[model samples]
Target: MLSVYVDLALGLTVSFLLLSLLVSGLNEAVVRLLSIRSKFLWAYLRDTMDGSDAQGRSWLPANPGEVFAALPFTRDPRPQHSDQPSPAQPGELPEREDKAEDAMVKLLYQRVQEIDHPKSGRTSIANIPPGRFAVALMELAASEPDGVEGFLGKLRSMGSPLYGHLKGVWETAQRDLDRFRQGVETWFDGEMQRLSMLYKRYVKWVVAVLGLLVTLVFTMDGLEYAKTLLRDNALRASVTAVAGAGPGAYEELKARCGGDDPVRCVTETLSQPALVTMVDHALVSVSFPAEGDPVVRWNGGAWWDRITTPSHWPGFLLTYVALLFGAPFWWDVLRRVTGLRSRR
Candidate 1:
């Protein structure tokens, strides 16, 4: 009975781990594909005009995208070199610009053509040096004919709004432009880092939510499935026998999942029909409401069925929490559980 219990529980656990791994990898890929963090920062920095102020006064410049475009902190596109290249035809014009593969890089390059490589004299800036963007903004602020106070006024006129805290900083560094610039850069760096962290947290949330939906769709609730094993003697005997052989199969499953590349790991592991059969066979053993269980209904059914079913909330809640443990964690858990069988 204990071995039977372990067999099904471990299978369900591995299934959730596999699904969670899928979710995590997709989250990482989608966040990069969408360039979520960079897009958020770009939108924040646009500083486009808002028509009415609290004082009901029309802010001077209605837009500031052009104002930002004139700044010198962005990177230019770099040319790619092919492994093998043929000489151009005698009259063939040399290629000019290669489109950037990264949207964020392309966006930055488009803005900084004039100042990308100030020393390079109108050539596109190959890359924005680290710490350059904030530094350039600070330099621009300090170089205004008036001090920080006056430069901020110009920004407000050009549609950039100021925070009270930033407005307050000018007084402390009133005597030293360099001090003011450093403070501004430090503040900007901190804010950008915060935004980056927030974006990462958002990606994690996406993975968790997606994992939840997947578990539900697949009916992978752990608690209910375990109960099925307990109630069905024939199914339990079959799974326990399968579980006896699971250690060898699990070793292979571990190797496939342990590969360096996540997509490759999932693809390779999923291709193993025997391993997949273990999970699918375990799922087949689950008892159902031949009567009217909402867990059986993918669509609208009864809210009461979900709430009243002893296994519903507990099973789903268990699976949901299991997903949060992540694939590596559960893979290790599976290893430990299998280790127990080996000891016997």
Candidate 2:
């Protein structure tokens, strides 16, 4: 009986975790689809490339999109303006000779070639050096008459977190061009690391908040489920039997929920999974409390009466906290619990 109880608890907990993970993964998918993180990075990169210190001058394109569109790092560069004639019909004419979508190549061939090196009095973007991205951008920033000071002023305008940290380093190394260049590169690297950390932290908070909302909707009262099992012998047996074999039902779970990746998961990518399916399965295998059992019919008037009752709030709270532990953590617990069953 005790083993059965343990199995029931472990099985249900694992299910809850899996469902929670599905929710969390979908939430992340929404964020990625909206390109929120990319937009932030794009802003950071924009400030770096297009920033100007001169009264009205900049060596690079002003728009972040345009800058990325003109870069080799990007896959689809923007098309450049051309004087070539256009084909009138579909499949009626041969391919156009001008491939203006090579914005980056045109940039390198034209703009980079137009700028003269302050020291060598020569023009070249590729010949500057083959190294880090930040180093290359800094060299471009220096292509203008104002030089390194132009880049420094741009960083200062943003009031970036690193700006304060780099104050002393900048002051000490400003005289040596090599050291100043290194310091700027270090600053860029630090900003990216900080952004990465903040982005991770943001995702965690999203999970917690989304978990709370999902638990409420599912009416997953952990206490109610526990109480239902403890006091009813028939219900306990049914749930225990199902749960003992729950590990074997993993393929069914996957088939229902689809693949692990949220993108390929069942149903809509961002829409919440039919959590009512989870609730129904649990109730069928476990049954509700005797007084509240759906089979017996009661004055409560609705099926959710079993969950929406104020008495179940505490259990709901527990479930909410459990959800925050995430799928990975619960998966580990489920593995250990099932391993013990196999051993016995």
Candidate 3:
């Protein structure tokens, strides 16, 4: 009797673990398809250069999106823009409204559109090394006819907040280019940390939505599965055996597929026989409606009930909540439980 409960516990854990992996895989594919990382990175750069907050509220005296557009790093170096002004042409001071800064801004905006939905080739890089960014910025400042000091004067005349920021960095570096680059790198790193937090928050919502969808599609009713496991001795023993057989494969999969490389992890792990078998068992445990067809027709039942009977709601909710705990959480639990069983 004690062993029966143990098997029931193990079976549910295994089921949830498999479902979590499926959700994780789908989440990765969705993220990649949407180019979410690239969008976040671009947003960060835009906010910084435009002197605006995340909500586009400006706190700075002057916008530097124009200055940023002048930098070569933001524009693609390909042949399509061969006839355009050289990115290094910042040496030529602003002419008129028709030819100088306005044209560059238009070109940069076009580049942004291309980045968001490219007709061909990969998306714009989601990450830029701090060192590379620092180099491009410093070189832009140095490219002026009178050099860095002259560039600072132009910014000061315009009451640009970026001038004050870079002036402090220049002073801290004591007029040394290498030290200035290093200081900029440190500043860029701090900004990247904030971007990382924002990206994580975005990912959390993706996980929540994806988990709910996967749970509903699989009809994974936790309470029903628990009742079945408790009542059927043969089914309980079989699930226990499968659960016991899984640890070796689980460890191998964990090592090969880590949190860092989610795309490859999803591609490889979902193809394994161990995961496939677990998913089969999970489907077998699903509870389908015995009365009217839940899909095609609805009788006098309440609108909500037509979606899922009241009795199954708790189980569906439970399964979805468990999935929100994520694959790594269940993986850890599974490892510890198997270790205890082995010792016994």
Candidate 2 lDDT over residue span 133-187, tens digit each: 4455445445535665554454455443334544555687865678867776676
TM-score ranking, high to low: 3, 2, 1
Candidate 3 lDDT by residue in tens digits, 1-344: 77777777787889899889999999888656655565456545543443343344432212233212322234322112222333543333233222222222233333333323342243445666777667656665666767677766665654444567678888999988788889988888877887787567657777898898777656667887787556454433433454668766445434444434534554443344232322333323322244655333332333334235778789889999999999989988888877744344
Number of residue pairs clashing in candidate 1, backbone atoms closer than 3 angstroms, sequence gap of 3 or more or interchain: 0
TM-score of each: 0.47, 0.49, 0.60
Off by over 4 Å in 3: 52-123, 154-164, 234-306, 340-344
Best by TM-score: 3
In candidate 3, position 118 carries an lDDT of 45
**Candidate 3 residue pairs in clash (backbone atoms < 3 Å):** none
* lDDT (Cα, 0-100) at 312 in candidate 1: 74
Candidate maximizing lDDT: 3
Q: Give Cα distance to truth, residue 127, candidate 1, Å.
A: 13
